[model samples]
Target: MTNPPYGTAPGGQWPPAGSPFTSPAAGPVSSQKQSRGPVIVSLIVAVLAIAVAIGAWFRTAHSDVTTQSTTAPQQFTTQQTSDANKALCDSYHKMFRSVNGAGGQTSDDPVLQQVYAINIRLATHVASDFMYDKLRENPAGSPQLASDLRDLANAYNEVLMAQLADAPKTELDPLYSNIDSADAKLVEACK
Candidate 1:
């Protein structure tokens, strides 16, 4: 007998390329399709794993941003100009009390010295206010007064500059001299 050309030889067991093979234990052709079920399940599991990873990344990023925003430091500022004024007034009273309590000793002691130093600063502060008011009230009232105000301002700046750290007392002597000069000029302008 001649074998069919498309499927398999009639006397032999080898199957043709187009013929489907069957296993002895498998019941039907549909059972082979069930083998692909595990592959589908693996694909589904991989996709779910990727989704969980993406969700975790977003949660961590959001938490990090929230912590950073909440932990920012706040700025500190004095509420009013009156605070500086009050500090100035209190400093003056403190100096007065210290000097008055010093029975017989000169004010060249450390406590009194600090008081003197800070008083000069206070004087400079008051003079600044006076000079500003003077300039604002009379822009071109008197040349001599204007010159005196300028001198006063320069002298105050010099004195304040002398109080800097690492500056020698000899350096500050000029500032004191300048202050005296300004005081004399102011007195002359008044007269």
Candidate 2:
């Protein structure tokens, strides 16, 4: 009346003493093999999904780096040019103020008038011979005109500052009228 091993069937008979279903003691001798179909398929799918994710990550990262590198250089160059142009504008403004004065007219003082005239001539020469020439040769974004203007402005500031300290009107006599003519020519060129 005792069962064969694991459990008795409804008819009170066990499958068999040596069968895998018949007893928990069965190990290597078991007849059934575990199914590996779903596990293998899952492993393959997981590997492919990971590969796709890695590839996508790398592609996007590379494109982003390339785009940033391309634009970075242009931004740097533009910023440098802008800074240089700003300096040029400042120098021009300073020179213009010194020559034209705060009163909106050239001074009546003979010495001051002569000084302004010389500065006007030097600035005119630079604007016409140097700046305009460079502008014509190199187009709108050229740095040459800005550089020359800054240089000429610096020179005028230095010389005029020295003259304002005590230098007589006659000290500038050598440059008189020649500068005026040059300025006149520059004005004409503008037209």
Candidate 3:
């Protein structure tokens, strides 16, 4: 049996006369070509967006550096530094007195003793941090005062660490001595 011709038109004609769907020879159909304009435009837009983002990032990074470099450190007057040092010394003295006062009130109960110890540690830490912050903010005009403040802060940090570790009095004595020496030097520098 023979198969019918594919795409047979009316009256059994393989190709209808002057039909637009198929060519007379019945080769491939002629379709319209897709436009590349939109695709090219989209690609250009994406590249431009990426370039703009990169440019903005570079500009922000440069401005940050520029701002940092242009900013100057705060300078303190001699009288201002002296007053700040005196205030800091007074605060430290008061804190030490309060700590000593608290130490005198002892409890027989282990729990109460532990609570007192924790409170004392917290007080000492707060006092140390306050002193450090004050020193940093005012920045003593005299180099000797600045050095002493640094030394005192370092000593206080060591004492705090020792206290946290539950170190014996023997281990902490040297750190306390360092603090006293620094404090004496700072007092002298302040005057």
Candidate 4:
């Protein structure tokens, strides 16, 4: 038997003429609006959010343990300050005494060099510990006093090193003079 002929959809047309959606083959490409603008924006936002989270995590992970403060700790007691100054002086005296007491163990001239090296090392360490770190530990300590102490300690150390190096007498004389001047200032400040 013969099949019935295909019939028009309506109004004698092959298919419905007017519809909201159209086949891609039947419509112009420009007529189809691209939805990529919003998608691109969403992707960028997600990437930025991930980056910020990673940065925040690293900041918290590797951070040092310290309090955030704009103010220094309370000052030392008057008696405490005096005692600390005395301790500073006493420590230096002890160091000198020990170095001097080690004399006569050897007649080799190199022994003096070794002793001088030890003195420089010891003096540098002590100065850093007492003059710098000690004052820093007490942040509320007098800044001018700290400055004087640091200068004095450094001046004393420079003279010792110059002497060890056997610098010319004129250079040695200036270094000694600087030590004496720094010492006078430190003494006044400590008092």
How does each model score on lDDT?
0.50, 0.45, 0.62, 0.54
Better of 1 and 3 by TM-score: 3
Tens digits of per-residue lDDT, candidate 4, 1-191, equal 25336654345643334543445665653666876645655665566557656754654321111121234545678887666666655544554455345432443555455544554545443453444444444444444565566676667668667765889998988876887787677656545
Pairs that clash in candidate 3: none
Best by TM-score: 3
TM-score of 2: 0.26
| Candidate 2 structure quality by residue, lDDT tens digits, 1-191 | 55444566667545556665655554456568877655655665566557656754654232332243345333236665555455444444454454555324487765555445544544443333333233223322323443344344334444454444656677655444444444444344323
Residue 128, candidate 3: alpha-carbon lDDT:
58
Given candidate 1, what's the lDDT at residue 141? 31
lDDT of 1 by residue, 1-191 (tens): 57576766666555433346754343354545445545654665566557656754653232332243256533424443334334333333443344334423447555555444445544454454444444433432344454556566667666666674547889888877986787676555444
TM for every model, in the order presented, reads: 0.39, 0.26, 0.49, 0.40
Which residue window of length 10 is worst by lDDT in model 2?
133-142
Root-mean-square deviation per candidate: 31.4, 31.7, 23.6, 24.3
Candidate 3 TM-score versus the reference: 0.49
lDDT of 2: 0.45
The regions of model 3 sitting more than 4 angstroms off are: 1-76, 186-191
Evaluated at residue 63, the lDDT of candidate 2 is 32
